[model samples]
Target: MSQMLALAILILVLFIGEAVSIRTKAWIPSIFVSGVLFLLGFWTFFPPEIVTLAGIPPAVAVMLIYLLITNMGTLLSLQELKEQWKTILIAISGILGIVAALFGIGTLLFDFQTVVVAIPPLVGGLVSALIMSEGAAAAGLPTLAVFAIVIYVVQGFAGYPLTSIMLKKEGKNLLEKFRNNELTAKQLPGEQSGTTEKTVREPRMFAKMPEKYNTDFFKFFRLALVGYLAYLTSVLLTPVVGISPFVLCLLFGVIARSIGFLERHPLQKANGFGFAIMGLLLFIFDGLKNATPSMMVEIMYPLIGCIVIGVAGMYIFSLIVGKLLKVSKEMAFAVSLTALYGFPADYIITVEVINSLTKDEQEREVLTSHMLPPMLVAGFITVTIVSVILAGIFVGFL
Candidate 1:
C-alpha cells in the first residue's frame, strides 16, 4: 500500500473507532476498536512500512507521556494528596500485587521466557512491553519477544471494560449519595482542601519568566522546556535518587507549577499535545499488525494465565489495602484496573462514568475533581513509572 493509503486508512479507522466508542458509551473503547480495525486493515493492505510511520521513538513517546502527566500535576492539590494518601498507597499496592502474582505463579507454570514476557505487559503499557520483548530478544528468546507485543495488544481488553464498568458503578453510587443528601460536594473526602477556608502561600516559580513572552505558544514552550529539564534532571538524579525519569517529571511538574513556570490552562489547551497522544495510541495499535495469528495462538495459554493471575492478584491486594485505607472495594478495583490500560482511556472512562451518572452541574464538578486525581495518579504510578522500572529490573533477570 502507498503511504497515503495507509495514512488514510489509519484516519478512517480512528474515526470509526471513536464513533463506535461514543455510540456504545465506551463499552468498547476507541483504541481497542481502532486496534481491531488496524489488524484487519493490515491483512488487506499488507503495508510493511506502516509501523515505521507510526513508530515514534521511545524518548519522544515518553516525553509526550511526561507532558500529559506533568499537566495532570498542575491540576492536583497538595492538600488533596495529603488527604487521599490512602488512594495513592492503594495504587502502589496494586502494582506490588501484579509483581508478586506474576513472578510467583508465572515461573511455576510457564517457561522462564514466557514468564518474562507476560510479566511486563501486566505491569504497564507499551514501554514495558517493548522493554521486556527487547530484553527477551537480546537473550535469544525470539518467540517470547513476539509474545510480549501480542500480550500488549490483548491486555487492553482486560483493562478497558473493567475500568468502564467499575467507574460507571462508582459514579452511580456517588450520584445516589448526592441525591439522598448523603454526600455533598464539599464533603467528598479528598476534596476537603477546596472546601475549607485556608490561606496558602503562593510560590512564584515563574517569576523569572518575563511577562512580555506570555503568549499561549510561549507558555507551552516554557512548559516543554521545563519537561526537558526534568528529563535531564531525571537522568542526572537517576544515579543518586534512583527514580525513573517519568517519576521525576511528576516532581518537576509540581515544582514548575509551584514556581509559576507551568500553568494548568496551557496544558489543558495544548491541541498538539493531545494529537500526539492519539498518534501514540495508533502506533501502539499498529504494532499489533505485525503479530501473526500463529504467534498469538502459540502463546494463548500463557497469555490468558498471566492476565488472569495478574488480575486476581490485583483484586486480592486491592481489597486488603482498600479496607485498611477505608476506601470502598469498587474504587479500589477501579484504580487498580488502570494498570491494564493507562492514561487516555482511564481519563475518558472516568469522565464518561461521571457524566453518565450525574445531571447536576455541582455534583458533576465535584465528582470529576475527586475522581480524576486518583485515576490519573494511579495510571502514572503503575503504568508510566513503576511499570518501566519493574520492567528494567525484570529484564535484567531475564
Candidate 2:
C-alpha cells in the first residue's frame, strides 16, 4: 500500500516538473523534474521507508520501453528527419565515435568492473540510461544511485546551453524559411515518376504544421504500432538472438524511412515532447530501484568521472563531426549541438542562437530543421537502449 502511494507521489512531482518546463522555456529542461524526484526518492524525502525497496519492478521498464519505442518510431518518420539526413549523420558519427573511444578509456581507467568499472553504456546509445539505473542497482555497484543522478543531471543541464549556442548560429534565415513556407520541395519533373506521384498525393496541410502535430489519432496509432512492433521484436530476439531490441527498432526506423514505409511528419512537436517526458520518467524510477545509502557511497569517483566525460565529450564531438560532414558551417554546429544534448535542448538552443544570428525567415527554419533530426533520433535511440538496460538489469532480468 505504501509503495503504491510512493509511486503516485513520483507521478505527481514529475508532472508538476513538466508543467514547470512548459512555463519557463529556460535551459532547465523538464527531465529535471524526473531527475529531482529520483533524488528525493534516494534521499528518502517522502515516506522515507519506500527507500527500503532494493530494485524496480520489471513492469516499470516494460511500460516505459513500449511508450518510448512507439515515440521513437513515430518521431523517426517525421518530416523533420526526412529533410535533414546529412547533418544528423555527421553529428551522430562524431557522437558514436567519441563515446566508443571513451568507453574503451573507461574500461581501462576503471579496471573493467562490468557494471561499475566499465564503459559499455557510455557510447553504446541512450539505452545506457536504463542500464545505468538497473545495472547499477542489481549488480550492487558502488554508488549506483549517484551515477544515475549524475547521468540525468548532465543530460538535462547540458541540453539547454549547448543547444542554444549551437543553433544561434543558424539565426534568422532558418526561421524566415519556415514562416515563408519554403521547406524546399522537389517533385518529379514528369508526373510519370512514382516517387513524385506519391509525394504529391500526400501533400501535407500547412495549417497543422505548427509544433502541436500529433493531435490526430491516426498519426498516434501509426507511431504506436511501429514502436510496439519494435518492442515485440526486441523481446523475441532477447531469448533467441541475445541482442537488444532497441538497436533493431532504430534500424527499423532507418529502414522505414529508406524503404518509404513512412514519409510524413508523424511526430508533432507536442508528441515528441510527450515522448521525452515518458522516457525520462522510466529513466528516473527504474534508476532508483537499487539506490541505497551504502551503495551510493562506494563508487562516487567513477560516477563523477563518467558524467564529466559524457557531457563535455558529446559537446566537442558534435562540432567536429559537423565540420567534417561539410554541412552549412552554421547548421553543422547547431545540428551537432543538438546531437550532443538531444531534442528540447537542441530546440531551445537552436532557437536562441538563430534569433541572435539572422532574422531571415528561410535560413532560420532551415537551420532549425537541420538541427531537429539529429537531436531527436539521437535522443530516441540513446535513451531507448541505455534506459532499458538500466531498468531491466535492476529488475533482476535481462
Candidate 3:
C-alpha cells in the first residue's frame, strides 16, 4: 500500500474505535477495537510495514513516550495526592495482591517466562506492555512479546463491566445514605467540606514570561529538556539505583512540575499530545505484524490464567485493605480495578453510574464528591506511577 493510503487506513481504524468507545460510554475500549482491527488486517492482506509506512517508526514512538510521560508528570497535584492517602494505600495493596497471586499461582500453571511477561501488563497499561514486549523481543522471545500486547488488548474487557458493576453498587449505596440524611455532601470522604481554607499558590518559574512568548515551541523545548535530563539521570543512576529511564522520566516530570519548571499537561498545552499518543499506538500495534492466528491461540491459556489470577488477587487484597481502612468494599474494588483501564474509563464509569442512579443535581454532586477522588487517585497511582516502575523491574527477569 502507498504510504498515504496506509496512514489513512490506520487513522480510520483509530477513528472508528474512538467513535465506538464514545457511543458506548467506553464499555468497549478504543484500544481493544483498534487492536482487533490491526490483528485482522495483519493476518490478511495488510502489509507488515504498514505502521512504518504511516510514518511512525520505533524511534519516533520511543521519543513520544518520553515527551508524553513528562507531560503526564505535570498533571500531578501533590495536595490532591496527600489528601487521598487511604486510596493510595488500597491501590498499592491491590497491586501487591496481583503480584503475589501471579507469582504463586500463575507461575505454577504457566512457565516462569509466560508469567513474567503477563504480570506487568496485568498490573498496568501500554507503557508496561511496551516495556515487557520490548524486553521479551530483545531476549529473543517474540511469542512472549506478543503475549504482553495481547494481555493489554483484552484486559479492559475484564475490567470495564466489573468496575461498572462495583461503581453502580457503591453509587446506589451512597445514594441511599444521602436520601436518609445519614450522609451529607460535606460528610463525603476525601472531599473538603467547604472552601474556607485558603490555598497558597506556589510561585511559577515562568510567571514573568509574556503569554505570547510562551509559545508551543517553548513548551516543547521545556518538555524535551526534562526528558533529556531524565535520560541522563537514568544513564548515571541505572546501575546504582536500578531504575529505568522511562520511570525516571515520570518522576522528573512530577518533580519538574512541582517546582513550576513545567506547566500542567504540557503536551496538551503544546497541542502535541494526540499525535504523540497516535505514534505510540502505532508503535504498539506494529508488534501485531508478526503475530499469527496460531500464535494467538497458543497464548490463550496463559493469557486467560494471568488475568483471572491477577484480578482475583487484586479484588481479595483491595477488599481486605478496604475493610481495615473503613472504606466501602465496592469503592475499594472499583479503585483496584483501575489497573485494568485507567483515567477516562475510571472517570466515565464513575459519572455514568452516578448519572444512572439519580436525577437530582445535589445527589449527583454528593456521589461524585465521594467517588471520583479515590478512583482518580487509584488510576494515577497504579497506571501512571506503579506500572512503569513495575515494568522496569519486571523486564529484567526476562
Candidate 4:
C-alpha cells in the first residue's frame, strides 16, 4: 500500500469507470462507477495506509468546490432568472416537500438518528454530506457521521435513472415542439423586466486578464486566491453569522465574478482547480472505504427506505407544486430530483438529453438554453444553498 501503488490503483479504477460509462452511454456517471470500483478495491487491496494515502487535504476539496460554485455563478445571471421564476419556485417547493416527507414518513420508519442523518443526502450534495457528518459526529453519533457519506452515494444510484428518464422525455418533447416551430423562451410574469437577450454574459472566446497576470497560470492563481480568500472570510464570519463556509464561498465567487477578479469559464482554463475537484472526489470514496461491508449491511434496509421515500416525496410534491406554478409535472419532477443528484449530474443530464433528441443546432440551442437555466439555478438553490442550511439546523437537533 505504497503511495505509488495507491495512485496507480486509483488511475486504473478511473479508466475502468470511463470505459464502462462510455459503454453504457453514461446512464452510469463515471464518478459513481469509480466509487463502486474503489469500494471493491479497498475491500480487496487497499490497506489502511493505502486508504489514508488515497485522500488529499480537505482544504483542497473546499477550495475546489468554491471555485466550482464561482464558475456556476458566472453561468447564471439574476436577470435570466426573471424568465425562470416558475422553475425556481417549483424547485423550492420540491425541497419543502422533501423536508416535510422526512418528518412525516421518515420518523415512522426510522429512528431519530437515522432521520436526522437522512436530512443531509435528502438535501443533496457533498457539502451537505460533510456538514451533516461533522454535526452528527459532534453530537457523539460517530456512526451517523458515516451515514451522511453513505446516503450521498446511495442517492446517486437511486437518482440517476430517474433523472436520465426525465431529461430524455423533456428533451424529446421539446424537440417535437421545435420541429413544429412552437418552442419559445417565454418571460414569465414577475421575471425581471428586460430584453429577451439581457446583458448576462457567456464566457468569451478571449477573456481579458487583469494587469500583472499575463499567463493562464497567473489567471488560475488569481482565481484560486479568490477562492482561498472567500474560504477564509467564511471561517471568520461562521461564528458571527452561523452560515456554512461553502455558502459563503459561493457568494464570494458570485461577487468576485461580478467585480472581474475571476474569469467566466474558470473550469475550462483552471487545470489545477479541476484536478483538485477530482482528487477531492477520490478522497470522498476513500472515506467510504472506512465503512466495511458489515457496516453497510447494518443500514441497508433503512437506506433503501430513505431512497424510495425521498424520491416518491419529490414526485408527489412536484405534482402539487407544478400545478400551482404552472410548470408541467414532468419538468417539475426532473428539477425536484436535483435534490438527489445535483450539479454536474444535472448539467450533464441536460446536455445528454438535448443531444439525444436533436441534431439541429438551432433546436438544440433553444432547448439547451431554456433547460439549462432551470437545472443550474435549481441545483444552486437546493444542493448548494438550502441543503447546507438544513444540515446545519438538523445536525443540532440530532
TM-score of each: 0.86, 0.59, 0.76, 0.82
> Where is model 1 more than 4 Å wrong at Cα?
1-5, 51-63, 186-213
Residue 29 deviation, candidate 2, in Å? 1.5
- Compared with the true structure, all predictions reach lDDT values of 0.73, 0.49, 0.80, 0.71
Per-residue lDDT tens digits of candidate 4, residues 1-398? 56777777877787787677666665665666777787777677677455446555565555566667666665555455566688878887888887778779988988978888887677678777888888888889887888888888767767767776777777778778867888865443112356331343222222443434446676567666766776788778777886655655556655665565555556666555456546656655666666678878977888888778877777888889899877877788888888886776677667766765667878777787768878877877788778877887777787
For lDDT, the strongest prediction is: 3
Q: After superposition, which runs of candidate 3 have C-alpha atoms over 4 Å from their true positions?
A: 111-113, 125-149, 160-203, 341-398
Please give, for residues 1-398, the per-residue lDDT of candidate 1 as tens digits.
56666666677888897788777876676776787777777766657557455445455565667677666666655555566677778888887887788878877987766776687678688889889989889999888888888887788778877777777777778777877988766443222354331332222455455656556677668768777887788788777776666666666776676555665535655556556666666666767776677777788898899899898888899989999888888899889988888776778778766766656899897788667778877887788877887788889877
Residue 381 lDDT in candidate 4 = 77
Model 3, CA-based lDDT: 0.80
Deviation (Å) of 149 in candidate 1? 2.4
Model 2, span 123-218: residue lDDT tens = 333445445656566667545434554444444444454444444434445455656887552321112335453354321333235525434555
Can you tell me which runs of candidate 4 are displaced by over 4 Å?
A: 2-5, 47-55, 134-143, 184-214, 258-261, 270-277, 355-364
Once model 3 is optimally superposed onto the true structure by TM-score, how far is the C-alpha of residue 398 displaced, in angstroms?
A: 7.5
Instruction: Please give the distance, in angstroms, between residue 243's alpha carbon in candidate 3 and its true position after superposition.
Output: 1.6
Cand. 4 TM to true fold: 0.82
The candidate scoring highest on TM-score is: 1
Give the clashing pairs for model 4.
82-191
Each candidate: how many clashes? 2, 41, 0, 1
| Least well predicted 10-residue stretch by lDDT in candidate 3 | 194-203
